[model samples]
Target chain A: MAESRRPLPRPTPETQHFWDGTRERELRLQRCDACSQVYFPPRPFCPACASRKVSVFAASGRGTLYSYVINHRAPPGSGFEPPYSIAVVELDEGPRMMTNIVGVPQTPEALQLDMPVEAVYEDFTDQITLPFFRPLEAS
Target chain B: MRPGSVAIVGAAETTELGRIPDQSQLQLHADAALNTLADAGLTPADVDGVATAGESPTGVAHYLGITPTWVDGTAVGGCSFMLHVRHAAAAINEGFCKTVLITHGESGRSRIGRGGFSRPAASLQGQFEAPFGTMGAPSTFTIPVLRYMKKYGVTEEQLAMVAVVQREWAARNPRASYRDPIDVDDVLSSDMIAYPFRKLMCCLVTDGGGALILTSAERARDFPQRPVYVIGTGESVETPMVSQMEDFTTSRAFRVSGRAAFEEAGIAHGDVDHLMIYDAFAHLPLYGLEDLGFVGRGEAADFVEERNTAEGGKLPLNTNGGGLSYMHSGMYGMYALQESVRQLRGTAPAQVKDARISIAHGVGGMFAASGTIVLSNEAR
Candidate 1:
């Protein structure tokens, strides 16, 4: 079998570390050695300080929902499904991530603005996994 | 840097807005491109530079049967072509080419019903966001609009004013999709797509093509008719993905580009007699109002609610109905420039009285890129 000819994003040189770290079920963040600004989508330099001296570090993977939308339309591709919760999450590391909001009903009636959520990595393949979020219970 | 004057010497539109069953995507682009050349009294040989985004240009290049000296296929966002137009002007000024042609076409209204090309930035948005029933534009844009309401003390009635005003402009044009008169009550009472934005608040997708011919001031003066000078133009890009945006309430990209355009044109924002802003949604103008320094933060609601953007109001916005009512093939910004050219030419049926100086704005990928072009009657 050709592994069902799945539609998975192939990591490029610009984003290899991000994919590799995700495979091992860890959230790696790129930090600017100059300004110490932690960022996502691994790049060559710091966005804030424009320093080339950047390093990767493990993140706590804890963040809160900044904003979200429920897409009722289906995206292109075989594995795609509709009515998903696409969200903008503000990580504790001061970086905002764009990911899906899960483990809750995808509805305008259910989704609340600025709600608390946490990241959990799901292994989809031996070489790939994704960091998805679930609702955090009230402390 | 100051560039030579550029005029919208030619402009044209396709048959329908939302969907056209009989035509291919390339056919739409070809029809408009060829028609615009005919309108300007030029041929394929006259165009040495071509710029476009949205779809690949292999077919368009083949259909037109003319190779370009410089061709830009940068696909940043819907307004990426607007950024391309600015680059085209720079190319013309440097003598890279004489006549630059800009065009866009899409079968979105037909092929996918509500489809979009594979956007590079959208991957920043996960597929998991869909199963939760994400309503696309309603979820992405309306959320920030809600934050606007909370911060600015703007009422729903104020937001409705944008839709009402555009409807008035759309009604004047025979080709507008939402041309029927819709009152403030109708706008307010329409079903909510996202909490803050209602049905009437969003733009309609139309299957069509739009393009323009831009030339140097001297070359334009030698042509058949008057040449509208591009006094000043500026562009800026922020976080391409919405997730990377620092603040939803403020558009930093708009603010930066607005300043550059104003400074380059040597004109105050208040000096603009006519305005043509991208209206992917009726609420989009509020972003322009604040970004252009037309109103203070959160004051856009009240400013628009007072009907300041209406046809007879101080600012006559989107005379050809805008993307909300006109055409949203891919890059609505190209049409924004075209509509302003019409109004300045006194050809717009909904033309503002004695309209001269105009401002055209384009919002690229997910509100990511912004470009402002100032058009005037005389060469600056």
Candidate 2:
């Protein structure tokens, strides 16, 4: 397979655990011990209470498609093909994440808002795994 | 202090509007500043305060030979200049400085000596928004439009009317980059950049700059040109990422900023003779109208479709064709302010007949930040 030229995420001291969880096919979020607030884009302190007493916990990878746009133009030097879907997936955990909707045609007709979705780990590099979302199949 | 306490005494754009390959970004700022200073019949030494964005305020001051006592470099986004005008007013009121000069220049199309702003891979947008292949403003900004359309039943035709009406205004502007007449069909037929947003719906990419000089209302008449009084100003910020916007249907920043400005100005919505909403995309005006309380929720798109914002409408918007049809040099708030000043001065090429009160509202990032300036020819 041609090496994916998509930009990869770099783990920082504050975001290492989140990436490590992604590497293990899990979506991790931080919950505040004081305010009981859950947040994404992990940080050491709770944005609500400014409390550092927070813990990272795995979340249910299931989410719903809040909104999205089908990009017809790929940015200059971006390796991704045109007509890819960029989406905002609202996790059942009450936080929204920016991700790509995969396993479906990148068309508005095919992509419906409020559709149930589940996270899929996409590896841009061997050491990096990013979470993408796809429509959950009916049982 | 009340907002009308300050006034804009001078305003000018770079000598040329579109595509100037010869000048660097800094040179564009200097060109605009020199033109504005000349319009006000003042030299750089007369400026006691300076503010700018996309470039350093210190650099602008040094280049313009302005040893300002107060300086602000609030690089919020396109709306940075609006916030600067507000901040300059506050500083002037508090006696921090007088005769403030706010400038903006961007070689967006030419990319000459433009600074880079690549976020660290671990940054919020980088780790969250960027990894999803969200491209430039065009792609990322589409997320809200899609949701807004679905919720409000705003048709593609209603959205296209924004560009169509703005182009009508641009046709009358000699300096507008694209003066050719276009309709909803033309906008719809244009190349699809992102789903629902065509090439015509997006703002032009051009190399240009604009500057404004503001002072207290007491010293306004000393300038060469008729001063445009700043009656009201407001600013607020949301999330930097478009996807993370609190509500895709409306911009919270626009509401907060617009409401504050309206309250401060003490002007009824109907009293606004002219309006300028920074239209980076066609949907922006819809959001601005609804959020600013000009029209009720979900009514802006239809209001626009009915020609409520066109040339002879109840409110004339984007008199300089806005960013959509006019020159958008990255930070577009300055250009919008320039139009407001022109309308109030009775000197705009496509002048609104007897236009007195003009509102210039701007969005910084992808609904991330906003600033509103309510201006009038008459001082309260």
Candidate 3:
């Protein structure tokens, strides 16, 4: 049996910069020039203030685990093993992003809520590099 | 809209509750719609408005041979039916259309003529969340519960108790898919699908559908069945992504929608005799109970643990076994609404005694949207 390919993010013009940063091994996020509100999952404008004067910059790459679930059932063709951690990490700059927690046991005892984590990049293809997180100490 | 100005004269689910591979998704919608119309002693010619969620209103209307003056295709997820009811009422009050028929059907389990649940690679979820190995509702919807539990001191046993009590109700309902008695241990020991969520904690993936017919309250007396007045209705949306929810512990959409419905009804929380919170997962009711103002924040787990939502309690919730034990087609809002109508009409299988007021609340996506409806046995 052939290994199923995992789904990859298809970036749009608005989100191209964030993906570009990931390829260069940097976590990028957007900040609003009007309200000074930092946001994630990159958008062209500030979600809070609706200001189009948003700027993208390399983020701190540090965050705390906000919430998560240890998924035992992987979607067919997702190329993930069972019992992986699917997590939402709240970044230091104040936005949550969904990412997998790497370099630790995927257990409730190990993945405590509010534990500090930092970003680590994995090059999936020449054009795509995914940003995952690890325990802050491990990173 | 004025309270009791609109009433549900016809409501019915497909004759068969589960596993209907023979029927296409649209056929299931037609089945439920035809059954509902028959219940009211009417036909397609009587309906001038059409509303549906899973399927386009135009398709449902044309398939049923009804020339509708008003059509609504609110595809907000499971709770789309509840919003349809609310919008249809407003449309009726404004004379946009007269008689409205709302339909819902999904071949959730069989996947018979059902659209794929895939997001476009460029879609927000595809770009931001899906690439992170999230399987489906089990992986995503169950994420916030741990945070909720940590903040509220809610134990896993209390969460399991939700499934247990709903099963107790299911035991009384012959139509429920799983009627056997289950305890907290049974739920906790069930196969783990996602961390902190077991198979029993998740809703059933069954194939079923339901429909409702709404008309002016003045003509409600002419119907064969007792009229379940649509006293109040409300709907709201929050975020598309579960990770971006305003707060992880509570659902803003549930709060906004529930409060609007209660205010419109001009009723107190104590007046509610029956309740049906969309139980896509066990944690949903916990959030619904708190967010809907039935219980204080962080109080729902304790409320369920004390059997307050069980039989012979102050409140009767999920009387039709809920989505947990009852048939949960992908879109479960219509079933929740159907159960509310049944309770208000004194026809539910696990009927609450003299249940005068029933509230049916539903959630769409992963707390992305919500719709709430307040029903009364009396027009006033």
lDDT of model 1 at residue B349?
Answer: 73
> What TM-score quantifies how close candidate 1 is to the native fold?
0.86
Per-residue C-alpha lDDT of model 1 across residues B262-281, encoded as one tens digit per residue: 88888877789998888787
Per-residue lDDT of B98-165 in model 2, one digit per residue for the tens?
Answer: 99999988999998989866867777888788877888888887788878888999999888999999
TM-score of chain A of 3: 0.94
Ranking by TM-score: 3, 2, 1
lDDT of 2 at B361: 98
Can you give the TM-score per candidate against the true fold? 0.86, 0.97, 0.98
Which candidate would rank higher by DockQ, 1 or 3? Answer: 3
In terms of TM-score, the best-performing candidate is 3
Please estimate how well model 1 matches the true structure, expressed as its whole-model Cα lDDT. Answer: 0.72
Q: In CAPRI terms, where does candidate 2 land? A: medium
| DockQ of all models, two decimals each | 0.23, 0.78, 0.84
Instruction: For model 2 chain B, give the 10-residue run with minimal summed lDDT.
Output: B115-124
Candidate 2: where are CA atoms >4 Å away? A75-77
Which whole-number lDDT from 0 to 100 does residue B177 have in model 2?
A: 95
Best by DockQ: 3
Docking class of 1: acceptable
